[model samples]
Target: MKVKAYITLKEGVLDPQGKAVEHALLSLGFQGVSGVRVGKYITFDIQVRSEAQARDQVEKMCQKLLANTTIESYQFEIIQS
Candidate 1:
């Protein structure tokens, strides 16, 4: 199974990179832009046979290495590949 993880800053946490991108867009004359949040997309293959197992392992991966958990949040999707 192929899994994708989306890691993002939690609410109330300041995102400097997101702010920079937003500022750049405003400087480039882009209008109607209010807020921007930058995040990370990570994809990998897991050798799990079942979706339940895959989700369990993926959640462990996120908690252990992929996300901060305190200031960051993560969501994942399983794709058959």
Candidate 2:
């Protein structure tokens, strides 16, 4: 199975990189940008017998290593391979 994770900062958290990207977009004459937030996308293959197992494994991976639950949140999707 293939799993993908999207990690993002929780609300009310300051994102310097997002701000910089927003600024750059505006400087490039691409207006209409009110707010910008940056995040991470991770994809990998896992050898699991079932979707349930894949989900469980990925959830643990997120909680333990992929994300910081205090300041960041993560969501994942699994694709059968």
Candidate 3:
């Protein structure tokens, strides 16, 4: 199975990188850019036998190391391909 993960800072969290990107966009004449936020996307190939297992393991992985749950949020999906 293949897994895809998206980790993002929760709403109300400060995102300096997103802010910088927004500023850069505005600088390049792309106006109306009110806000911007950034996140991470991770994909992996795994040998899990079932979707449930993949989801469980990936969720655990994210909670344990891929994300800081106190200050951030993460969501993952198991793509059976």
Candidate 4:
């Protein structure tokens, strides 16, 4: 199975990188864009026979290593491959 994980900062957290991108876009004449938040996308393969097992492993991976859990939140999708 393949897993795709998205990790992002929680609400009310300041994202300097996102802010920088927003500012650069505004300066380049990109309009109507606001509240830009930057995040991480990870894709990898997991050896699992069932979706339930894959989900359980991925959740643990995120909690233990992939995400901060305090200032960051994560979501993942399992894709058969």
Q: What is the lDDT of residue 24 in candidate 4?
A: 96
Please give, for residues 5-38, the per-residue lDDT of candidate 4 as tens digits.
9999999999999999999999999999899999
The global C-alpha lDDT for each of the candidates, from Candidate 1 onward, is 0.95, 0.95, 0.90, 0.97
Most TM-score-accurate candidate: 2
Error of 2 at 28 (Å): 0.4
Q: Where does the lowest 10-residue lDDT sum fall in candidate 4?
A: 42-51
TM-score per model over all chains: 0.95, 0.97, 0.94, 0.96
**For every candidate, C-alpha RMSD to the true structure in Å:** 0.8, 0.6, 0.8, 0.6
After TM-score superposition, what is the CA distance of residue 39 in candidate 4 from its true location, in Å? Answer: 0.5
For candidate 4, give the lDDT of residue 79: 93
2 versus 3: better TM-score goes to: 2
What tens digits encode model 1's per-residue C-alpha lDDT throughout 1-81? 999999999999999999999999999999888679999999999997799999999999999999999999999999987
Q: Which portions of model 1 miss their true places by more than 4 Å? A: none
- Worst window of 10 by summed lDDT in candidate 1: 31-40
Give the TM-score (vs. native) of candidate 2. 0.97
Residue-level lDDT tens digits of model 3 in 1-81: 888889999999999999999999999999899779999998898898788888889889999999999978998888778
List runs of model 3 lying over 4 Å from the truth. Answer: none
